[model samples]
Target: MDNVRTDKWLWAARFFKTRSLATDAVDTGRVKLDGDRIKPARAVKVGDKLAIDNGSDAWEVVVLGISDKRGAAPVARALYEETEASIVKRENDSQARKIYREPASTIKGRPTKRDRRQLGKAGE
Candidate 1:
């Protein structure tokens, strides 16, 4: 297991848009390892559990390997492993959110050009 930098791991795992952002997340305690907040330069090894609060959804994964550079999706997949239950719950929550969304209104027919010209936002 490589003693990997927290910022680098986050970037390699596609958790942040850039290494700097990853560092910022670490500094702010948005990223955690083994149940404790870690610094941007902290070393991580295989079997370490990472909990990341990424705004919309939280992420939890176990480190399987380490790399300083971001890799392809398949390569990234080898770096850490996510639980099946986490994936299922996130998917179901997403679907539920979508189901409750309001659809757009449909008009009966297109308006004439004159009607379009006459239509204007009323002064509030």
Candidate 2:
């Protein structure tokens, strides 16, 4: 196909795990076409530029191929070409995360009463 719906393309390209998730991302403005927020049904063609933020990572890519079918990772990867800047930024962000992680992320589930007491004492 010469063009495909943005959400379908995102799902086929493996940017999101499911088409529903891709649609949600587009609806929430986390997916943009040529820097403009676009509806999930918007059509995407080859050479179209897309900016996508899928929670854990952001991508700036140029469409290289179009397909509505979800395929293997290698095939999905061929659908779009990520910008060099996006790759470098993602690597830097990954390194920074490795060096310094959010302290709250270490907490497992709900804190126990004893843990709460310790936190209270620490606050004081």
Overall lDDT per candidate, in order of appearance: 0.79, 0.93
Residue-level lDDT of model 1, residues 3-60, one tens digit each, is 7798988899888878998899899999988779888898978888888866666778
Worst 10 residues of 1 by lDDT: 100-109
Q: What's the true lDDT of residue 9 in model 2?
A: 96
Name the top TM-score candidate: 2
Candidate 2 vs. true structure, TM-score? 0.89
State candidate 1's TM-score. 0.72
Candidate 2 structure quality by residue, lDDT tens digits, 1-124: 7868999999999999999999999999999888889999888999999999999999999999999999999999999999999999999999999998864566699988877787778669
Give every collision pair in model 2.
Answer: none
Predict model 2's lDDT versus the native: 0.93
Best lDDT among the predictions, by candidate number: 2
